[model samples]
Target: MAAEIRTFTCLTDNFGYLIHDPATKATASVDAPEAGPIIRALEREGWTLTDILITHHHGDHVGGVAELKQRYGCRVVAPHDKSTKIANVDLRVVNADVIKVGSLLARVVETPGHTLDHVSYVFDAEKVVFAADTLFSIGCGRVFEGNYPMMWDSLLKLRALPDDFRLYCGHEYTASNVKFALTVEPDNPALKARAEEVARLRAENKPTVPTLLGDEKKANVFLRADEPSVAARLHMKGADPAQIFGELRERKNKS
Candidate 1:
């Protein structure tokens, strides 16, 4: 009676997740970066495509919607703000909206920064989040649609979630991101242990996502803006937390 979530790497780095509810043999794809892998997974699991959830309008995230929708005639769900760009959306949802995958419920979290129309789905009942590009494993998405302050605000909202919440980010860039993190906190023991573990995982070409929020808070500098050590490293000069986060984002963009 166990529900399973299967992830397939699409494009070069993007991830496409399929949450399978065995009880109903229903599946939902978090983002459709590509159709080939997703189509294959559906066949492999003998699951019906119940829904397609889009986090943002980015091409890498929604490029396969039309094809997949036509293939399975699945219901498409997207953020209400980007309904215009999301083709054939069945339900335009807003923040706090709850949707179901069989019996499990997932709440929509309006997290904008990487994109103004961005949203992340939080499966609070399962302690899992489909964070898209808002919050990565060790690094966040580069600011493209919003500024430092907006991104900082968005990140703060996510940081406030329960420590045990597991983050399922959009990309498989943990190894490189960990390398950049070391430049910011070279002496952090947590970062050191995680880096070694990430190296081993990447060496075997394994995915390094779905990290716990508490672990990211300790090792990821972007999630550590409130800490004195990160503040000093970013040379906040006694500025507020928002200002410090802004500075670090700018530095990373240039780094």
Candidate 2:
């Protein structure tokens, strides 16, 4: 029942994860933005990659698939919709598909806001979710191929997860996200406190990921779009929650 989650930085602000289960000596790599760094992480961890769990077809998310598969001979599991782009995809799974890695079971959640094919892997046993780009520490992914309402629906699915679930997103943009969040929810006390904390963490050169779901519910504008406080701050009365979330997301992009 032993497990470890390792985070690696890649390509400016992208994050890649290496998840290992010690009970069966099995490992899974999530959204490897690059091959070399993931390889280095695997070697340093003394874990052999048994599977590669991809969330989408974006280059940053699937760029290392070809090389890693050739090198580790690991099964590449990705969303069924993007099988064409993922190299040597051995298992094409859809929403709710459950895959096993040692004692850990990963349940696939179809979170298609960042992209129509985007997915999130939920490790239910550990109460954590590899949220790719759909959900971030203080922000959410840009609506690349989806609309405001659609993205809102996608986020709603994630909001139901346990409040304690640790969310490991696909990028390192917490510091920047907090800045924009302040502009949108300037009066939010929780957001103000979080912005200060993020500043300190960045100043110290520390990681700001693996943020809890509860904190996001309080500080992330996307999650708070429905709160009267958030809607009031946006200067729109009785605004559609999804529209508010989308506007906040747009602001973050240009932040």
Clashing pairs in 1: none
Each prediction's total of clashing residue pairs, residues at least 3 apart in sequence or on different chains, is 0, 0
Instruction: Write down the TM-score of every candidate.
Output: 0.96, 0.96
Candidate 2 lDDT score relative to the true structure: 0.87
What's the CA error at residue 99 for candidate 2, in Å?
0.8
The sequence of per-residue lDDT tens digits that candidate 1 reaches over residues 1-255 is 666889879999998899878877778999899889899988998888989989999999988899999999998989998544878788988989998888878899888889988999888877888999999988898888887778888888888889999899999988878888898899999999899999988888889977999998889888887788888887765778778777777777787
Lowest summed lDDT across 10 adjacent residues in model 1 is found at 81-90
Q: How far is candidate 1 from the true structure (C-alpha RMSD, Å)?
A: 1.3
* Cα lDDT computed for each candidate against the true fold: 0.87, 0.87
How well does model 1 score by local distance difference test?
Answer: 0.87
What does the lDDT read for residue 10 in candidate 2?
Answer: 81
